[model samples]
Target: MKKNYVVMDGNTAAAYSAYAFTEVAAIYPITPSSPMAEKVDEWSAKGKKNLFGSTVDVIQMQSEAGAAGTCHGSLQAGALTTTFTSSQGLMLMIPAMYAMGGQFLPSVMHIASRVVTSNHHSIFGDHTDFMTCRMTGYAMLMSSCPQEAMDLAAVAHLSAISGRYAFMHCFDGFRTSHEMQRIEALDYEDLRGLVDQEALQAFRRQSLNPEHPTNRGNNVNPDIYFQCKEGANVKANSLPDTVQHYMDEINKLTGRDYKLFNYYGAPDAEEVIVVMCSASETVKETVDYLNAQGRKVGMVQIHLYRPFSVSHFAAAIPATCKRIAVLDRNKETGSVGEPVYLDVVTALNQAGRGDIRVVGGRYGLSSKDTTPGQIVAVYDNLEKDEPKNNFTIGINDDVTFTSLDYKEIELPHPGQISCKLWGLGGDGTVGANKNAISTIGFVGGKYAQAYFSYDTMKSGGLTQSHLRFGDEPIRSTYLVSSADFVACHAPTYVSKYDLTEDLKEGGTFLLNCPWT
Candidate 1:
């Protein structure tokens, strides 16, 4: 029987799953992602045994480099090892990560995707950390939600052990990590059955054994060095198929579909948005809203980031998609375009679809708010046929401006049971919504969705939560344009902006304020 549970945030769910499967866990705490490590420590302290039927050995190191070293050592000893980190901590592990891949070590790293600080320090969600690891030969997979996070974490582990390649499983930090939801808890027995027993036995047998008396890690001369490197490359290239096979099996069992590049929306839509990570959810919602209004729009969510399956991406995107907006969280300073955007344009050109107009934009860096209003702006630009080459969203660009003029448009439907909340930065409004979503996940016959938006300037910046619960999976993207219920935590914001612009007639509005 399937079991269901509530989780407060993405970090907690990731920690729970890590503790369930990991035999050895090495960690170095960093903001946004620190809670993941903290949860694992708490579980270990309580003597919770993992699925391997052994107590998890937790290692806290001085720095990210030390944690990576510990992970490499543990994996070499034939133990299933895992680690959690973000930002500079992830960058610190790159050197060891390259070596681990070269040695074909089966290990997994859960990254709460965060921004790589520049100019000033920011401890928020972005893909800069994970993007830096792309060249290290690790297989990268991104999860859009907590449910996918749990399921794909298992898939990453199973594939790593079977394929002998390290796996980097990431989701947006704070956005997905700190956001709460209810998802069906995975069965450990089913996971155990998925492991390749014979391959695992072979790995144990190949460990340094006195009986076998084999010489390993021999330094090679130039004569065979190139040949050895090429052999390793060939083996690494074959891992994507291996990873996909396991994903298909998991989907069959769970009734959830997954692929290297998953397409959502009309198969023959004329316009599409290509994106990765948690933001894809918001895009999907927007696509649905536009499609319902008779606008032919669709989305392609990239799940596999590292391998960059060009053929798969081209196939998933419809040829009729003339206007493409590739939104990236990370920016490449002084470059022609952002990484993912560049890849998409290249894929389309290589596929002989150069007629498609591709525009790139940077949004939500350092966890800056990306709301449906901003997404609708992208579509509005497409409709006007005035697509900007390099655009930035969620900001007012007075100098060197490349932003499209966006007016707030009300959604036709207030949506089914739309719930909005206003809370202070640390007052736990975001945390409370996560708990509520987890509760809804436990209740049968309801599909729950949540979106959060925060201001760029930290102090006094607004934070709002848009949530919806209904009988069917909520496909409306963008944001709660027509909100039935609005909660205002900072009563002062109502004086600054039109908080009730999208509030439907006869809708409920809750304000958390003093009786003044």
Candidate 2:
């Protein structure tokens, strides 16, 4: 089957989907998520039309709060409005989020999930930023990678329109937001067919118009305030089905199956790990490796995080599973467990499956690498008589001794070629490799992925570019530990760092030197 494939990063994928449905996009610049707003702004300037047959109205606001305010007002005025933000920007949008939810407005906020700055500032990927808005009444949906970012964004917006509730479409910042991959692009015509025209007409009819002159946002007495809040219960309860309906529509169009919770690995697995976002990709790889070696291990990848569907989650879990490990990307101080972990335990209890021994662990904070080795450790921890709760992985926590011991395990892809390039952050190596991967993926008709890592001082700091090409989808989320090819674009980098340490035994190493 032919697919209109395009090479893009998570931010671009999100921008493309949001642009298809949005009539107005309120914009504010923030790292990772900024590219999404930039793309929408660029497209709007170029007169790109949405499904409504008109170019989107791109409005740049002074602050994230103002941007969110713009989206709320536009949505109230009967426009399909959206905004892109992350980290502190999401924090500033809390007030607007409450209003959107209370009014049951169909607004989709695209977020490149980032670490929330506390003691120090970090512009990296994690669930810290997205977790803060859990109680704001907006339904949360997570995308595991660039492709899902595009697909799930459509689900978020489509479901929001039909369900009359706001949706937060989130993907990991930097890891996904900056990482480029080849994905099947969605056409506006395909999207237009899936839209709920009746629901949209209803929304417009309910809009604040001079002809209608409807009163809203009126102060309510305490007598009926709680009861009034309960008015949204029916919509909230039906949201999971609403989202699933859109996801099925997307699957019919894209030829990819999606669910509220996607289960993978052994059907009768005794041990399982539950995770969300990009880490799910790495865990899937580990599950395949372990399952191949006769381990009864599996994984439950979450797509719809908000309106957490207990029935769907319970159905996704194998009945044979005896032990479960839950990994969350964010850390919550003084809490018994992180958000996802708490939700999983509650779902299990509600499903009357509380006999399963469950443990929660934290991993991949601030875009920390979550490798297969660490995933193996989590599975190993579940094998213990009493698995450790509130444990951490991918770090040696000697102070608290809460980290599990892990053995390095390498899973090789037979057809994929991995390449690594070392260069300065501002140098053209990253951009060159990005182009190279896009050419290979699109022009050459091959699956490809490219990810770049740099330090805090980005301009002059060391940068490592990881590129992969294969006949099948590339699931390696972590840095290239053993590359088939290695290149050093900087002359002096040979002496400064062990650049060839990760190169394969028979890999070719290219170095730029004046003498050579």
Candidate 3:
């Protein structure tokens, strides 16, 4: 099958990848994640045939919990089932997720992972929601951006079908989920060829059949309950290899190497940042810039998190990495450190890396800005003799006094053209930006990216659109702080939001208004 490229957001990418293989999708609409389910529903409505030569059965549930319950039922009845959710919607699915995992039902839950109503019920990007589901026995796969969101999402489905553990494939909520990017897609035939036919057939044979019915989710006493629960450890421990095997197979097909942890930087980097999600892309750009300047710095991007292999993580780190900063997108207060930080500490401890100093910091809660400058601050902290035990970035934390000082540095993206659009919800601003990106990316042969942000409720709510395209693959994940073009489609928003706050010198500003 020939490869094709399209300009699309993370949600659309996930939908397309899953739609190719899925037999059933239990859907519930939630901000930043609704588009994924909507895409599946629309396609199913249009009678889109999956590789199985049948249109996927999309069932819209009353709630997220209903979606999860239905997903479990579908998987039990021998169907490849999935769902898309985030934040509170995800929390509602926990009980069913446990049942599905406990029963060893293979399913995939595509999450545009978001902050779960912390400071406020923010419908924004973060790992706080994903962090809470770490112990659910699901194979948690993290994708840094839309492309990986598409690639690893397929990996998740493949892994689930082959392995006993279900999968939760996640990325930054609005940053990646709503952000559009041009990417070379995996051909459906190529992806289909990678699925283990024997494993899938065996799974189908094991499904619930009236001809050979069996009782699951039964009440068990302490007698054999512990043994039955601990019995899954063998399969659970084997997930790392299972995930890596598919990643390797994908690399062979695509010529792109993907592993549990991918390292990018100078060969002998003394300082490094270990992170995941879209921020890894931003950090990679920082690493590339710093490496050219003779700085021995690098980054380790974590893709497989649940069954994190300490050996693989240790192997990925440069032997010369003396100081490392683990950036946590979600803050787990009252713990030793944030989720990933603790995991990194445990991994390093297991690998006997006592010589390397590892510190943790928090950033990007509820979609707060996490720029390259903030990442540079993380590296600077690594250079310190005694860096702040736990620091914050992209904010002034005067109360805790744990904020890192960083000089705002300009990102050097070649042939980059950034644009900003301001409009109200349902005003077609987001739609227009999507079309603009598609035109530039598919026709102009330029790499393109776009992201939209707006509150769910609010009359005449303001929506911010960030669009960028260039000759090279665009990596900056955060919103456009500075743009070459700015447009305001809603005249009333002029007094409410700063439209040209980040416009560059000689930048074009277009305002839509009545000629009074």
Per-residue lDDT over 1-516 for candidate 1, one digit per residue giving the tens place of the 0 to 100 score: 465555445777777767777888898898678888888888888888788787788899999999999998888777889999999999999999988877888878999999888887787788999988877888898988877788888888888888878889999987787665556667777777888888777777766656776776788999999998888767767877888888997897688899888999887887788888888887877777788888888889998877777777888988778888899999888999999999999988998889988888988888776766788888767666677878988888899896766666544443367877776666678767766765675554467767666655534567778787766655443357667788888767778878787687999887788877
Model 3 superposed RMSD (Cα): 1.6
Task: Residues 386-496, candidate 3: write the lDDT tens digits.
Answer: 988789999998897989998888888767999989888888888888898999999999999988877666335778888999898899888798899999998887888
| Per-prediction CA RMSD (Å) | 3.5, 1.0, 1.6
Reference-based TM-score, model 1: 0.87
Q: Single out the weakest 10-residue window by summed lDDT for candidate 1.
A: 407-416
Collision pairs in model 3:
none
List, residue by residue over 171-279, the lDDT tens digit for candidate 2: 9999999889999998878898889999999999989999879888998899999998898888889999999999999999989989999999999999999999999
User: Candidate 1: which stretches are off by over 4 Å?
Assistant: 1-8, 208-226, 352-355, 380-386, 410-415, 420-446, 449-468, 474-516
Q: Which is the winner by lDDT between candidate 2 and candidate 3?
A: 2
**Lowest lDDT 10-residue stretch of candidate 3:** 453-462
* Highest-TM-score candidate: 2
Ranking by lDDT: 2, 3, 1
Instruction: Say which prediction, candidate 1 or candidate 2, comes out ahead on TM-score.
Output: 2
Candidate 2 versus the native: TM-score? 0.99
